[model samples]
Target: DEVFTGDERWRGLPVPAGDRFAWEPESTYIRRAPYFDGMPKTPEPIADIRAGRVLCLLGDSITTDHISPAGSIRKTSPAGQYLVAHAVQPVDFNSYGSRRGNHEVMVRGTFANVRLKNLLAPGTEGPVTVHLPDGEQMTIYDASVKYLREGVPLIVIAGQEYGSGSSRDWAAKGPRLLGVRAVIAQSYERIHRSNLVGMGILPLQFLANDTPASLGLSGKESFDIVGLADVLAEGFPRGKDVEVKATRPDGSGVRFKANVRIDTPQELQYYRHGGILEYVLRQLRDAGR
Candidate 1:
């Protein structure tokens, strides 16, 4: 009777309850499902994210499009090839847009299809080249894994409109998966920048013509964002300068300033919680109390 009354009340409301009102039926079905028998479920490991130390940035003339494409995908791309290699049914491979939900798929796709030449691979002086655990000239993805394994932090340096194009969350999600803790750029596209913050990746802006060239940063240099906790604790107000120390490949270091983009008190909460999803889920779980 309580269930029926709850359902009626839900349906009578102006806003649609959709599938939420079917929770009782769904729970019943889940209990009876064959695969529901004594399965061990593991919680997501949210505490493992440490601050990155070794920063790598690979971008080309069309870097923004590569990082966050405008739409869809062709069957011949690296992402498509990876899916095919894994025996994903042809239709299931789908568009890049559809596959963002899978971290493995998105990380493999990060620098796979970018037409711009990788700046950190061997035979380049642009930035220090990172050798992959694999013997190949390391792509950005490979190098990221190596750095992550070594317990080194990472940041991405980009030119104008760092994240442009579609509002797909994967554009930001992929970097977080790769262990990038921050991104410094000349400028950022609005939606992607917000998405980066949502994923708990610090989006920093370089002011006063402090381009990668001006700062002389290459892929080989490591970066440290000192006083990160202090900035977050004090509230990341606009015009707040966070110190970014860049170590060059030649063992020289340069110190530059970046503006913190954490614009609101709510955003600070998200950063403290590791991400927006974790923050919201924690809130929801607590609300039941």
Candidate 2:
């Protein structure tokens, strides 16, 4: 107590006088955000994702670093352009990790990893993806922007071991912001699967020996993940097989079985409510009332 309140070290520190820390424009520690709103405040249940367009088709071993990377922001990138619009110069546009407090920057930097190679844009490297049906070559962020504008839900088609790196929340958060409703992969890293559930994103796992290549998925297909809300509503057990159908534009498609990766009852509740954060906030709000 004496050391905390009466010590010379505490007193010698430059303390700004106030009940609250004064916010300033140049202070990188953002208080009143020049960039973002907090997570979804309105309590909403996780509804079934429908008619999701293919966002990206990636190969095995995709990592959290691919979802949200740490690197120099390119002047041509969306996040860089945003910072520049706000009068932040190119040098002031730091890495994604540095600007995480700013959601706008983080979301833009998502899938902007310098090494990310989206299979949809074969022979392309570094954040580029081919927007399906339209076939426009653009940045991943740009594709997501176009999808969002069209009210099209998004899904990521992947090879095995999706999200197979350090447990990073932004891997899930970034996808969610891009309107990704589900990730259909051959397998998932355990913690990343949970993170997906926590973020209200469905983690769908392919059946044994089946994969995007084996299933002939070109990543140009429109996918329907059926029996999510309905199965849950009808007392479906955890980890049950779900039926997924993918339809190409030419009226041809494939149907297959994928297990819902939601593991526990509590996680299911979080998924049902859109996310763990939203579920917790709603519970707190209800208790207060």
Candidate 3:
């Protein structure tokens, strides 16, 4: 009893008291998320995706680890550069899992597995992609930055079992932050599909046994997800069939149908409101009225 009573090491620690906890701006471990930044009381209407560029073309069995790596951060990676710029040494740069609270790091770590093979940048491995309309080869994070700067939406094309490994939330959150508006894949791991919707990313599945290879999608064409504007106007019909048109530089295009992957009515509601966070915020704001 004396030994237990004598422990006063933490008694003098400071305790913060406030209605809203102040986030430390200088701390890299946990930063304020920008998910609700500029969020309006009501969501704008969801529109069709036009002229979307393929960010990466991946093969089958791509795991959540491939989408959001949790291992040691490379000194040359975008996430590493961010930390270094903030005066953190390479030795202090921790694994991605350890820094998950920081969106800046996690977003850069998306699709950054050292073993990942993005077919868009052939013969190269690990977080590399080719920016469209210029054929400029750069890191996936860099290309995403360029694409976002140019006001272009991004998409990822993949074969079967996409997001097949551990159910990591960052797998979905990271892609959404990288300006990836949609993912068209042969199949998706169940939880990852839900996560995608939870992050306000449209998940589409190819129809009629269609594959990107069968459709001759070279990953360089400009894609338009047709019927989304109409579907959103008509209330985002569940599992609606939508046409995808991939137009090449020559102006010729291939069209195919894909099924929306929003499975439940609640998921549809979340997607319509631009994600669960936004939906819940509006709900709370309106409830007081």
Candidate number achieving the greatest TM-score relative to the actual structure = 3
Report the lDDT of model 3 for residue 103.
96
* Candidate 3 lDDT over residue span 1-289, tens digit each: 6765445666566767799978989888899989999888788888899999999999999999999999999999999999999999999998999999999999999999999999989999999999999999999999999999999999999999999989999999999999999999999999999999999999999885799999999999999998987876666477688899999988999999998998888888899888888999989999989
Instruction: Report the CA-based lDDT of candidate 3 relative to the real structure.
Output: 0.92
TM-scores across all candidates?
Answer: 0.71, 0.87, 0.95
Model 1 worst lDDT run, 10 consecutive residues: 27-36
Kindly list the per-residue Cα lDDT of model 1 for residues 1-289, writing each as its tens digit.
5766677668688764576543232221122212122322322332322334434455533344466443454456545666666676567766655655445556656645445444555355321335532334545565677776777767777777767655667677777777778888888888777788888788888887788887777655557776666665566556787788767656788988898887777777776676786677677777887
Per-residue lDDT tens digits for candidate 2, residues 66-154, read 88886788888888888888888897787888777676787888889888888888898888887878899998899999998989999
Q: Provide the lDDT at 150 for model 2.
A: 89
In the predicted model 3, the residue pairs found to clash are none
If both were scored by lDDT, which would come out higher, candidate 1 or candidate 2?
2
Off by over 4 Å in 2: 2-46
Per-prediction CA RMSD (Å)? 8.5, 3.3, 2.5
Candidate with the larger TM-score of 1 and 3: 3
Arrange candidates by TM-score, descending. Answer: 3, 2, 1
**How high is the lDDT of residue 104 in model 3?**
95
